[model samples]
Target: MARVTVEDCLEHVENRFELVMLSTKRARQLATGGKEPLVQWENDKPTVVALREIAEGLMSYEFIAEQEIVQDEPLFAAFEDESNEAV
Candidate 1:
């Protein structure tokens, strides 16, 4: 298997925020004990599973920036509430 770099994982994480958050939560769970690695593919490419796996562990709260939802106050409040509920 090829070596997985941190940068590679981070790029994916930035682009796929929701998946990264889910994977990060899973990665933390999997990291507790000695466990085997899981396989994950990137756009049909056989990426280094380890990098994507580690990226999941390193997920942070990400804000999506788009035209319709970038500066909406109500959306921000709702999102904040949702985040609080998640915690």
Candidate 2:
């Protein structure tokens, strides 16, 4: 199939914001080598692979929520550290 577009993914995820969040999170995981691509890679970038996975019904918000997504330190924590250094 041709490169998966946002329109294709929208069919699976009703909300654009939610679709962006899911695709972003999935891309990050793939970039870090923390998770395997649900769809064939085909030399596509991580984000593209992620979008394709979602477009093809291979990944979904509920499914991702069920998996343990590795989260980075919260944004507030980083700001706090910077503030302490400046104080």
Candidate 3:
């Protein structure tokens, strides 16, 4: 089996941390059977499939960032509320 290196995926992502986060989120989605992978094989795990997708530019960083922003809105709102209460 071929290993997917971070270097192979760097062109698709801005940095290693973002790559890791995106790949891991995709892997979780695959693990939960959320969607069919862009690339498919019998033996590869979800994490491997995610890395392959990243390396192949099948996933967009904008999509990931948007998802993160949507997910974080509640936390940000709560922080704002707390600050307002303190003021």
Clashes of each: 1, 0, 0
After superposition, the stretches of candidate 3 with alpha carbons farther than 4 Å from their true spots are: 63-87
Candidate 3 at 54: error in angstroms?
A: 0.4
The 10-residue segment with the lowest total lDDT in model 2: 61-70
lDDT to native, each model: 0.48, 0.85, 0.81
Q: Which of 1 and 2 is the better model by TM-score?
A: 2
Tens digit of per-residue lDDT, candidate 2, span 1-87: 596778889998988998999999889878985788878889788999999999998888677777765678775998899899998
User: Which of 2 and 3 is the better model by TM-score?
Assistant: 2
> How many steric overlaps does candidate 3 have?
0
Q: Give every collision pair in model 3.
A: none
Q: Would you list the rank order by lDDT, best first?
A: 2, 3, 1
After superposition, the stretches of candidate 1 with alpha carbons farther than 4 Å from their true spots are 15-24, 33-37, 40-50, 54-87
- Looking at model 1, which ten-residue stretch has the lowest summed lDDT? 60-69
Q: List the residue pairs that clash in candidate 2.
A: none
Q: Report the Cα lDDT for candidate 2.
A: 0.85
Question: Candidate 1 on 1-87: residue-level lDDT in tens?
Answer: 455665656665555565555455444434553334555454422223434555555433331111112464765798899899999
lDDT of 1 at 56: 51
